[model samples]
Target: MTSLAPSGHLTIGEHQLEYRMIGPSPAEGPTLVLLHEGLGCVGLWGDFPDRLAAATGADVFVYSRAGYGGSSPVQLPRPVDYMHREALDVLPRVLDAIGFRRGLLIGHSDGASIAAIYAGGVPDHRVRGVSLIAPHFIVEDTSVQSIAEIKTAYETTELRTKLAKWHKDVDNAFYGWNDAWLDPAFRAWDISDHLAYIRVPMQIVQGADDQYGTLKQIEIAEAECYCPVEALVIPGAGHSPHREAAEATLRAVAEFADRILNGHGEAAHGQAA
Candidate 1:
């Protein structure tokens, strides 16, 4: 993978976000915008961005949201609409700040749901496709249970210590997501209606053993989305398929990007079962 240093500080409103751009420029092809998971930051992505750039030959852009990594700090107890705000408002500004020409959104977990919302809410022609990994369309008991367990681990185990190394304000980052999900009002949160508005091709990657969500998320995409949808269910993998099954995840994403973004004709409208 080609080495490219992160370009620091893109101010999206009152906050400054840390971001990195790798591989070719927008002039070369559509950029791949990576949205990290609930507890994730740009640094937490490890070498995946580099490997993805190597695999897809498209520019890879990654950033740490407020309070994560080296990005500007945000207050604790974030609003329930945090994900929706990020997708509907902040993400578009980030893209514009970077001068994104055309792109694909590759999002994981919480990030994936944000991408789904963005694609559906925004009528941006630049978004050519979306690749979701372990995305949640609606709140579930399993998801709530898993998040509650993680909160316990954060307080009791070495999880906080480990995460502290990645986030500037670990509590802000942790509680922002935790409190919102655990809030009773968040139970009504769902993005399934947004799927019907998504017109770009989509690829869904999920771990069969994902503790946070189920195939119901993918089923919603297949059922509601008018765009072509492809699904990849990896066995023996859990929540983070890109981490647990790197090669397979990378190949699937790269191939999808090639077919949808670099192909000669419009993507076919069908479901890949």
Candidate 2:
């Protein structure tokens, strides 16, 4: 149940990323890597990381990507392929730098997409399972509309001021994600092809009332992925289930991680009939 402060930094390429570690040491049980959402960072995760650690007894490694929190800033107008680049390029290095052993990826929104891409693209044996919260597998009108609404809020409301507290370069953090999603070409952005390649068990958690995405995201996983896929739709929760419905999300994630990492079930592979 030990929670360590996020006083560590790792150099990935030219960027300095800020991260926090909780629970047992790396030599202990499997690690849970917490990947933040589009506008999220290490600080934005609040007490969820600590609670997850205490509940599962697994080391939780949470980090702020470039241009967010205390991490290095990035150029504006990020490419629409940013998530793909992060999953294929940056995540592998981060895992290596952290000496990642056996692990499970717990990701939210943009972070969840990255985890899905990585699990499908890389042949890393260290990744045992994936828990995706509010993940988007395809571009939907609802997601775009929500992103547009947030953009307006950022410009006119206190959202920008609130986010500034978490991001060192708030504009870069916001615009990078906002602009990419709102771009006309991004409407065709889809990661459903990646799901077919994922070899590990996966748990997809989404809020029943998630404004940013629809249940179609989970349906794609069930239809495409060769691995076992479980879906949870929490009522009264929105896009950020881990934040909106913390207790329920924590219980589901903790149980799934325990089962996958502790060898409590049969292997999860092969296409569904």
Best by the lDDT measure: 2
lDDT of 1 by residue, 1-273 (tens): 223345678878999899888854554567899999999999999999899988777899999988788898888788898999999999999888777888799999999999999999999999999999999999989999999999999999999999999998899889988999999999999999999999998999998899999888888889999988888888878899999988888878888887876784333323222
Backbone clashes, each candidate: 0, 0
**Predictions in order: lDDT:** 0.88, 0.89
* Window of ten residues with lowest summed lDDT in model 2: 264-273
With candidate 2 superimposed using the best TM-score fit, by how many Å does residue 255's alpha carbon deviate from the native? 0.4
TM-score of each: 0.93, 0.94
- Colliding residue pairs in candidate 2: none
lDDT of 2 by residue, 1-273 (tens): 233344678899999999998854554567999999999999999999999888877889999999889999988789989999999999999888877888899999999999999999999999999999999899999999999999999999999999999999999999999999999999999999999999998999899899999989988999999998988888889999898988888888888888887755443222211
C-alpha lDDT of residue 133 in model 1: 90
RMSD per prediction, one decimal? 3.3, 4.1
For candidate 2, give the lDDT of residue 192: 96
